[model samples]
Target: MRTKLATAVGAAALIVVGIGGAQQASAAPKAAPQAGLSGSKTWGNTVGWATCSGTGTFRVKAICKWEGDKHTSWVTLRGGSAKLVPPACRFKIERIGVHQSV
Candidate 1:
């Protein structure tokens, strides 16, 4: 009887842990600036693209590309490198119009 009780307890514990894990996995990650912020440039293609408000995981990954127009170059914003408290966010660039006007 003791052995049976122990087994049952273990099973119950497993079930609880499993349920918790599932809930965490299924829960939608809250995204910061949860809308088009017009400054969160994720990507671009010579002309137009999408922009985000900030950077962070929000049930989906952030991605954008842009061409600098005398201001930024090769601009991009991505998710955090670690589990960010507020989340490290920035715009990345890989070009230099240098007054060339991208």
Candidate 2:
């Protein structure tokens, strides 16, 4: 009886240790993707473009619209500019917005 009880207790203790190790492993910080320039704009005579330019830690969003088609783009930047241009369509700058990323 004593040996059986000890065996059960040992198994339970091992399970607790395993759970703790798993929690610690999951809690470890994960590497984030490098923040950089992404996506591009289409160019044309009728295709209008809107640029959101700024410096410092922030996000910039630009919305452009044509007769019925619309395009939107955004970027998170430490310091740079992001442009949104409609593809093969006459678009006007609907709006440009900026907000702090942090």
The sequence of per-residue lDDT tens digits that candidate 2 reaches over residues 4-101 is: 99999999999999899889856633311224333333344444444444443333333445554443433455556655453444456554333333
Per TM-score, the best of the predicted structures is 2
* Deviation of model 2 at 82, angstroms: 30
| Candidate 1's TM-score | 0.31
Off-target runs (Cα >4 Å) in candidate 1 are 30-102
* Residue 97, model 2: Cα distance from true site in angstroms: 37
Q: What lDDT does model 2 reach?
A: 0.48
Candidate 2: regions farther than 4 A off = 36-102
lDDT (10s digit) by residue, model 1, range 1-102? 999999999999999998998897455333334442223323332222233333432222322235212222222335432221111224543322111101
